[model samples]
Target: MAMFRIFLGAVFAAIAIYTIITGTSHGWNLVPVFFGDMAAMNWPGQFNFDFFTFLLLSGLWLAWRHHFTPAGLLLGIIGVFGGMLFLSAYLLVASIRAKGDIAEIMLGRARASAIGKQ
Candidate 1:
């Protein structure tokens, strides 16, 4: 759990720094560049497609984790668009809130509590 927290922190920091640097240089207009790569149908495009699928899965998991409530749906959208920016921080916080409980970390509070009762 400690290692996982550390890893999430490192991922958040690294991605934050990279985003700042890239945004400063490119002015944050990422949608076009992101899709443009896919349109070109090359290696970067292939990688982008793969990455997009992962984002979709991440979003879906987040929604499912919260049982697809309104807030869960909102989180799912944000997870897709915000990507690691949202996820790393979210996981870091969730890890802290879960207090080393892997089930709680993955399942959210209510579900985790229900499982615990079982």
Candidate 2:
């Protein structure tokens, strides 16, 4: 689980970095590709790069701690799960076209609902 957390943290950090870099350079054109076209058309300015920076840093911190307080755990789970879902939905067609292992890939989703128990 720790390894999984670390891997997820790294992925999110890389993504946040990419979003910041490319968005600053190209006015967030990368967002539509990274997220979705609908999101690109209606992105919330409140949930911009700074928000992602906080999210990415929080994920990294929680992963390094090995465990979290209930709220932190919830955040970690949402970060992992939401990230996976968003990525999966966006890539489903591509994966199907490439004949990839969909089930294996989907196991990446760390359900946020599990955090409700905490």
Candidate 3:
């Protein structure tokens, strides 16, 4: 599990980096285009909304799991703006930190819920 996490994380981080580099070609003008895409009111618009919903969930999870720390907030913002590229990599790191302990990974940094067990 640890190895898988590391491997997947590396892949995601690399992909995200590549995406960032590629996106630079578009410059900042896409900010308005982003809103326009969301406002299209067609299948593509629906898809955009679907992705936004996922982004919201990702941000919520990050904030919830990281004890609402600054790092958590920052990552949440990144997840919102950077999308799955940031999220997959973040999950990879978290999974690696869990170190094959499913409970720790699922429960975030607080394993109190799994304490006092055999």
lDDT of 2: 0.50
The model with the greatest TM-score is 1
TM-score of 1: 0.94
Over the stretch 2-117, how does candidate 1's per-residue lDDT look in tens digits? 89889989998999999999999989999999999999999999999999999999999899988999999999999999999899998989889888889988999988999899
lDDT of each: 0.93, 0.50, 0.74
Model 3 Cα lDDT, one tens digit per residue, 1-118: 8577777778787887776776797665655766678898877778888888998888877777778899988877888886777777777777767766667765675653547363
TM-score rank order: 1, 3, 2
Q: Model 2, poorest ten-residue lDDT window?
A: 104-113
Q: On residues 53-101, what C-alpha lDDT tens digit does candidate 2 reach at each position?
A: 6657646544433346676566465655356433333345334543454
- Cα deviation at 60, candidate 3, in Å, is 0.5
Clashing pairs in 1: none
Give model 2's TM-score versus the native structure.
Answer: 0.30
Colliding residue pairs in candidate 3: none
